[model samples]
Target: MSFNITDEEVKKLEDVASQVRRDILRMVHGCGSGHPGGALGCTDLLVALYFKEMTHNPEFSMDGKDEDLFFLSNGHISAVLYSTLARAGYFPVPELATHRKINSRLQGHPATEEGLPGIRMASGSLGQGLSVAAGAAQTKKLNGDDKFVYVLMGDGEQQEGQIWEAAMYAPHNKVDNLIGFVDYNNAQIDGSTDEVLNLLDLGAKYKAFGWHVITCEKGNDMKTVLETIQEAKAASKQGTPVMVLLKTEMGHPIDFMVGTHKWHGQAPNDEQLASALGQVKETLGDY
Candidate 1:
């Protein structure tokens, strides 16, 4: 089932996001690693996609046949994707405990060697997933599959020359089936993106690259997040690929981590985990 979202159903998606956030915190806290800031910030966006937007089977497949595919370019946020995949029924939620451990399919970032059900690429080195997604879009086109290819990247990843090349390639090649998302939280591992390296006017930049661009002003809001994806998909139908600039708080819902760059790769301690968990409701129980 893809989606037929309504106002009343927004709460359902919010519950999914909340539990996913808790999973993210616990997964990172359990392993004492993983990037929670971007994971938490991008929770609503992923939840909106997996739970309410993308049409795909829970059964794993290396070649996603006739289905919508997702690629996580900023692989450091593996916590969110693992949580989303588990919650979406790709695997048992308890499997989240295996993350970051030796021999675990759920690596610190999404890993293909482990044959992770939902991950098509091992994408830790930033600024590469967009091109991968673009290639997948082209494959689907050649295979006569109209399904969409979705990819998410960090705002800081925009600095990479490879990303710009793919950004230019997608629209120029008329790969309209691909939808790209940028987690515009402004926080990167080292510091705020502006402090590190300014990425100005992403909407204008993507538009200039010939992409149909959309802005999600409040990506943390489930309704707005889901609605924005719908808008992006609609925009992608007219022979131009779409790129969405999703504005988010680096560490959303967690009071101490919110709006800061410090939590990018830092896991919360025992007391901190307790407090963070309090802010995010635990639904569907924790893995």
Candidate 2:
């Protein structure tokens, strides 16, 4: 499908991104433990997809028809996806308050077991969601559905061999309907990506893997993100898969949290949470 985001739509996405940031901090604080760095880093991209890009009916079930599918490969950041999906009306935003709680549909990682409306597959395990997205893309082609499948992965998660395997399969099988995004924030659970396991030259790596690569220096910028996604869609040919390596600062807009790996899997205390929420206006009201 062709992308047509208006200026008004971009503004709405920006607002949504702010609300998503609020939800991420609140959810992690509620859980008392979870990933927040990657969650904050990917907030803009997720907001752009759910609010301004993807053709999805939050009310509709995940049946793989008439909807553009999105898979979050690095599932530890479920807070971002959960908040975006909720704000987009996939589910009530109140559910975010229950994130990572026992028996809550909002799990620490996305899971089909809860029958979550927006989540099609369980994704905590790194390196698997791309294959799922590729399979969905192939299915759409076979069934004559022209919709696209989008998947998001962390830059560090590339260390998983399964990702490269899916990378090889998507182009060989001509899964042009699939587009993958990497949250190239350079921070993971333990430390910076380069310090842990260097994924340098990610663009060249994707190019060598036979996929079209696009780079976005500021993944958190709404207008730039919208334009980059449009460019990626325009660049999609019938034979090559597309990947966007989005450079973003983890825990962005929160001065204390930005550029640190500490927020990768740690919750903010009450004072810190208040500070974070103070920066983000509660547009559409908090749950």
Q: Top TM-score: which candidate number?
A: 1
For candidate 1, the 10 contiguous residues with the lowest summed lDDT are 1-10
lDDT of 2 by residue, 181-232 (tens): 9999999878899999998898998898899999999898988888888888
Model 1 Cα lDDT, one tens digit per residue, 1-287? 25457877798889999999999999999989879999999999999888879998989888999989999999999999999999999988899998899888898878888787888889998899999999999999999999999999999999999999998899989999999999999988788898899997889999999999999899999888887998888888689999999999988989999968999999999999999999988778887
Q: TM-score per candidate, in order?
A: 0.97, 0.97
Question: Listing every candidate in turn, what is its Cα RMSD in Å to the true structure after a full C-alpha superposition?
Answer: 1.9, 1.7
CA lDDT, every model vs. true structure: 0.91, 0.89
Once model 1 is optimally superposed onto the true structure by TM-score, how far is the C-alpha of residue 48 displaced, in angstroms?
0.8
The lDDT of model 2 is 0.89
RMSD of 1: 1.9
Error of 1 at 214 (Å): 0.6
Pairs of colliding residues, candidate 2: none
